[model samples]
Structure formats: structure tokens, C-alpha cells
Target: MDMSRLIETPLHRLAHGRTGDKGNRINISVIAYRAEFFPVIREQVTAERVAELFSHRRPTKVERYELPRLGALNFVIDDVLEGGVNDALNLDGHGKTNAFLVLSIPVWVPETILQLREEITA
Candidate 1:
């Protein structure tokens, strides 16, 4: 998984949302670690782009946050799940549907990080 290629993939741009904040209409965030990966991550995760990806899901808001010290990017996505925590707990049939929904969306991670993990294991 080359870092450059991975960033360009359609899957990498999935699972994002748009901002509803006044005067700051465009803001987007994708989760990742490592400073080297931020440029590509930031470029692909624009608010407009995110809004398109999650248009069907229709979250209320999306905001980006930098956590350099933790080497992770945090995204605050509002209203992703309907009826919130209580709805989650009252899920039918042992939560398989909810689990499937979560698995359907792709999560982006740096290729360099994957390479490092492979090296460590090898």
C-alpha cells in the first residue's frame, strides 16, 4: 500500500462529513497518524468532499482536529447514528446490523504505518 496511491483511492475519501458551523462552511477531517501523511490526508478530506461521501447518511456536522502529540487525527461527526446511545443499546438481534453498518464504511490509515508494522512483525 503506497502512501501516495492509498490517499488517492476512492475508499480513502469515504466515511467523512461536512461542517454546519456558521462562517466556516468547509471543514473536514479524516483519521490518521504521522505528520508525513497529513498533507495528502488533508487534501482529500475537504468539507465538500466529505459532504458528498456522507450525503446519504446525512450527519449534522463534521469538524477536524489535530492531535500531533498522539499522532492521530480526530474527527467530530455529529448525528451519525439515529436516536443516539439509547438506540444503540436497544438494538435488535444481538447488534449484528449495527456491526455490519460500521464495517461497511472504510477507515483510512497511512501506508507507511502499515509498512512499519510489517517490518516489526518480520
Candidate 2:
């Protein structure tokens, strides 16, 4: 299908993510809300793309591991924490809010695949 015609929507509509951090590295898991949406995420949400999204954090490396059976993707980002929870000066240094940031990334999905919701129309 030609993706050019697809609508861009925040990832939260299709999936949810959680974050865990150890030292300067953070692990995030993006799981599709439905199996049908997995392929869309798998194709668009690459490790490089994710790293780009967090470019301000200056991650040294970003790795994505796929769990097709569970319709999920795990991302491990390195060198983003400034040291570790005990060492970083930021208020949310452990990076728990990073998951919500990831969920806000825009993804293009076929218009037909989306079920228009009243809330969105309003």
C-alpha cells in the first residue's frame, strides 16, 4: 500500500510503552494494542528512528529487539541518563517519563485502518 496517503497519528493510539532504566541506559517496551497494528509499528518504529527521536539525549547507541509473538518491540538506549539514578541531576533522572515521550511519536497508518472515534471528531 502507498503509505503517502496514510494519516499521521501519535503512537499512543496504536500502542503503549513502559520504561526501565539501569545506569545510563534505558529500556522501553512498545506493545501493540492489537495484533493487526503490529506490522505497522514494526515497519515504522526502527531503532535508528527512535534514537533520532531522542537525539537531544545524545544516546550512544539504540538497539531494538523484536518479540513478534507478543506483538512488541523492546528498545535499549545507551548513554542517556548522564550516569545513573543516584548520579543524574534531573528531577526524573530514572527516565520513567521517557516512555510517555516515546508514545507521543507520530506514526503514519492507513486511514482505513483507523476507526474514527467520537472524541477525536469532537
* Candidate 2 per-residue C-alpha lDDT over 1-122 given as tens digits, one digit per residue, 9 for 90 to 100: 63545889999898889999998899999998877778889999999889998998799999999999999999999988876687898899898889888888899887766554223445
List the candidates' TM-scores in order. Answer: 0.45, 0.88
lDDT of 2: 0.87
User: How far out, in Å, is residue 12 in model 2?
Assistant: 0.8
Error of 2 at 26 (Å): 0.6
Summing lDDT over every window of 10 consecutive residues in candidate 2, give the lowest-scoring window: 113-122
Return the lDDT, model 1, position 76: 50
